[model samples]
Target: MHLKIGEVSTIVVSSPEVAKEVLQTNDLNFADRPHQLGADIMCYGSTDIATSPYGGYWKQLRKICTIELLGATRVRSFQSIREEEVSKLITYISANTGSSINLSNKVAAMTSSITSRASFGVKYKDQDAFISLMRKLVTLAEGFIIMDLFPSQKWLHIISGMKPKLEKMHKQFDMIFENIIAEVEKTGGEVETESLLSVLLNIKDHQDLGFPLTMNNIKAVILDMFVAGSETTSAVIDWTMSEILKNPRVMIKAQEEVRKVFGSKGYSDETSLEDLKYLKAVIKETLRLHPPTPLLLPRECRETCDLKGYTIPVGTKVIVNAWAIGRDPEYWSEPEKFVPERFIDHPIDYKGFNMEYIPFGAGRRSCPGISFALPSIELCLAQLLYYYNWDLPSGGIMENIQMTEALGSSSRRASNLILVPISHNHV
Candidate 1:
């Protein structure tokens, strides 16, 4: 698991035991985030919580993120937005029930709309353009991982042209955020309800936070949260659906649970989904196999330390392969199979406490947005199960459905998830 990638000496943690050590036992030693050219350009010099250096400033930003931006209360406040967007998605599916519809595109759009509305509020004057811009930025930001490996080689960044491309997109992102900030400033915070942007603007002048919150800071945080919220949430739903479809037994059992639990209510919502244990298990299984960020954001060793027998020198990059750890045969009974039943009665959960199941990650830098993400992921799957009976398109075989991971920034299926939806009511 130890090797040299380009000029960087790296350690890849693929076992749960080593993962716990890096993420928890010696978390402080590996808490720092490595510099990425794409993140620097997109996140305003890595000032965002996800890319920021581990320190008082980053700690303060994480506090704001957990308490103000994506805390339980904040996540609860966005329920209506999620429900509304998911409803539109259900309707769209119902309308095209007999034909093949691209589930991935619809899911992505719904999540994007929800993220935008939650971040900037209902009046998004340039939503179409902004969403398009965000899509590009997320792809570019994640693309920077490879270029970052050769950080000492400055010429490679220029020769690849990714830096200039990111700079150009960053300008576009800056302008869009400026308009949104201007709108928030004119209103002097929201009159009735506060969006994430308004919340930050209202407290930007507060002196207790330790770091001055600038316009760029606000913009970077927004971009980071948006990318994490929209792209990954949709990807999980896509994978969950794909898994359920490929395994007919899971699909039937999950749909039965969803219908029995929420079918009586005519629609599924965030609150009611808590009772669908089977559906939740299915989602957990999906996350176990297809983590949103398979190789999580790289962590830099702050100081030299002895990990087991090896000397992990200072400044070495460490990557905890959550995907590999989740599928480790020592931990899972049948690592390759799509078995939701394995998690149905298990005590392990996704709260990062159980090292074997750190889907949202673990320790101080763990994703604080879990509360913000789960409701969307749960609601989308519940509604899909409760409303439709999906099938492969004509001539398509379920066993042959491609689960090939996409080559881009995320682990999305290379091809679109085109399925035929049969109305549950009609069935």
Candidate 2:
């Protein structure tokens, strides 16, 4: 469909066929990331995987992501961390039995802690500082900066005063990242721990791949893992909790299934996690309704490509609205409702494909953290439901739950998901 945002004429590709063309068939013609002054400065001039232009360098970085960091073997190695965190969540909920709990905040903290530990080997003792900083940066990045829309409007940064704010944020981020890098370096490179940063530092030492990994590149990668991995995973858990709470029957059934399968496990472990298939379905359904990143990061056309009858010009910014596509009436029945049963026997999965379910995106440029994210979300949701019966605080009803979307580089729950948890007898 045609869309007019201000003076620009844009086409919105809500159809799966068109989405396929832009994301897969003519994928190369649409793999570039839209340039942003703030993003460039934050990512150390597009050195990160998410913003880097498609080329040999990007390919190499993507390889490092897939084969080393987010690869199946490496992701599996973090199972212990996930299990330990989920256990902590369960314990916290149990302790707060009768009081209202902000599940979103807790989940966000859990994911961020896990990501920090896994990626940087540092877990923030006071997570709020990090979370606040990230939220601020996300807001700055998502807003419409004049520089992004009109590359020629270079003076607007000064006139609008966005330059100073952007510079301040950049400095703050650099200090945080550099501090972590320095601490890692202090470990003397012989630590038995195998965190992502340690691996990257090792590769940097070898420097056999032509371009050596600079401090800027290392910082960008660390930022990507922290921001991209943390917020989205936390948001997914929040949505899952909200949906299940809204539908108490579904919540009960899911909880029962988890408790039944894990019975005497004492804690939610990797073994028990594999058996919570119904809970997994709940997470998939949540992603369907509330894609953390409502609009997948904008992709720029690399070359001219024909879609339907129109020629998509090279360098044109293309955005795949996974949010709308996931809820398209033609694809999902009662698209707005939260229903995990929809996946009972359905083969559609989020490892891309199933255009109607492109939560993690599709094809070559799809999110590399898909494996890490799903398990983390699944385990957290399962543990929460298995151990507690949730209700809104102070006579709060499902309607009272805030469904407002937080505006940022990604979509998230506008309000912290606060609920009272009652200890489950079965567990």
Candidate 3:
């Protein structure tokens, strides 16, 4: 559907066919992201990989991300960090067993610790504050930008206090990141394994990076990885668990698969995850039902183009609602159910090739954290299922599980998920 939001032309694609046309067929035409107030303030003036406009600079950033930061070897190197963090999580949860625990808080902490340790060499002292700042930034970035829909009306931003709000928030994040860098500098590269920050700092002054990476640029990338990686993965884990808990059948089957794979092994390893097919399907189904980012970051129309016979004029902001497409009745049978079996024989995956299942998105603008995120998710999910048998608090049943969604750019459960965990081996 096409609508005129203020002065900007907007194209909202809610179906797979239209989404395919915008994301794949005429991808180049809508490759650039619409410049908005929130991204400008939070993304270091649209300099980060996720918000950067499609061009030589963005291309170079993408290359660096794929080849250096998130390369297969680099992603593999973080397994130890993930394993350590998951172990800590198990211990933490183990301590709280028999009591109704807030799994969401624990999950967020787990993801934050792993991401911080991997990205910054060590977990910083201000980790919780940093995560809080990042969440606020995400909220601002997902906010309504008066100037975005009506570019000529820049004054509205100031009038609404959005501009000042974003600027203030940006300053807070900048200071937090500045301290992070200073701490790393003080370490003098003492760490044996280089963190992503260390690697980027090493290359920041390189003459061959096509364009010199400024300090802000490095900070932008760091913020990108930290903010994007932690929250999304945490939300996925939380939602997947919620779905499984809501459907006892799925929980039983997925737990059976997990326990069977890790029987007597005590915990799940990277190798063991490959054999947990049913658990994999459960994750996929969870993603389908609840993608972290429902309305993917909006794209800009670089040029006038036709998408499924609809003429999208130049400068129109295009938004492909991945959430809607995933649940479209035409592509999915009983689109609302938490049925993992739907993927047993289905070829749809998160690799972006399958239009119907793009939880991570599709095309040149798709998320690059797949390699970095999937292992962490699987490991955490496997360990959680393998070690504990979960039940709702105070004899709460599956039907009462709060599935209400918190409204945001990335939606999570509106309330923290509290569950009772029973240790399988009576530890």
Candidate 4:
């Protein structure tokens, strides 16, 4: 279908064939990101992985992300942090048994802590200022700044009084990054522990490959990891809980599987989690219904391209509406229902190869945090179900579960998910 929003004519690629042509066959032509003034500033002149133009710089940064930061080995190395955070979450929920617990807030805290510790060598609990700064950054990223969509409307920043707000956020983020860099420098060439910041600092010091990694570059990378990595993982967990509560049968089935697999094993490890076929299905179903970023990041065309007989001009913003695509009746039966069983014998996955299941997006610009994010979600969900049985507070029925979404870079629960945890033994 061809649709026009303002002067731009968009070719909506809902069909798998069209989607493949746009995202894969002519992917290089659509690899660029649309120009956004606020994004340029926040991303340090669009050097960050998500906003960078399709070129050598993007390739370099993505190499760093995949090989140095979010690579399978690197993500696996953070298992201790994952275990520790999941343990804390379990402890906290157990301590609050019978009380209405805000699972969403707790899960958000868990993800924030893990991401902070892994990326910056500082956990949220250890640094109050950093935690506050992270909260501010998430808020700023979510809020609409006039300059983002309209770069030429420079006066709107002043007229709408958004300039000061943006300036304040920039200053605060700079200070936060500066403090982190300063502390890392204080270590002074010692064989310090490995962290994302430390690795970048080493690259900067060595001037690896003759490309100097500047402070702004480091800050941009850190901001990318912090904002994208933390929020999406947190939001998914919140949605998973909501969906589980909304369908008790699915919840009980998942819980039974987790417990049966890990019985008397004390704590479930990564190996144990991998065998959780049904639990994996539940997570997949949750993502299908409520992808964290409903509309994958917009792609800008670097050259004209033809998709299904429509010409998409250069510089046109291409938005792959994953939310709409996931719910399309043509692709899915009972598209609106919360049905994990749909995936039991299904071959669809979110690794971008499958056009219909691109929750993490597709092609080269797809999210690099998929490996890290999935385990974090699976482990958290597994532990929650294994340790305690949950229910809507006040003996409420499953129908009481609200599916309303809170808008931002990622869509989250409109209201925090409060559920009563009954000990599995009691159940």
Measured by lDDT, the strongest candidate is: 3
Q: Give one digit per residue, the lDDT tens place, for model 1 in 1-427.
A: 9979877898999988998899999999999998878878889999998889999989988988888888777888888888899999998988898899999888988887888778887545777787688777666655545577787677786678778888899898888878876785787665335688878876897647866888889888888777778888988999999998889889889988888887667778887878989988998999999988888788999999999788999999998888889999999988999998898789988778888888778998887776777899999988888888888889688878889997654567777799999898823
Better of 3 and 4 by TM-score: 3
lDDT tens digits by residue: candidate 4, 7-68: 45455555556667778888888888877656676678877888888888788889888888
* Candidate 2, 379-399: lDDT as tens digits: 787778777777788888875
* Model 3 ranges with Cα > 4 A deviation: none
User: Which window of 10 residues has the lowest lDDT sum in candidate 2?
Assistant: 2-11
- Write the number of the candidate with greater lDDT, choosing between 2 and 4: 2
Give the lDDT of residue 382 in candidate 4: 89
Give me the runs in candidate 4 sitting further than 4 Å from their true place.
Answer: 1-15, 124-145, 186-193
TM-score for each predicted model, relative to the true structure? 0.95, 0.95, 0.97, 0.92
Q: Which model, 1 or 3, shows the larger TM-score?
A: 3
In model 2, where do residues sit more than 4 Å from their true spots? 2-9, 189-192
Best by TM-score: 3
Tell me how candidate 3 scores on lDDT: 0.86
Point out where model 1 deviates above 4 Å: 123-125, 141-147, 183-192
lDDT of each: 0.84, 0.79, 0.86, 0.79
Q: Ten residues in a row with the worst lDDT in model 1? A: 137-146
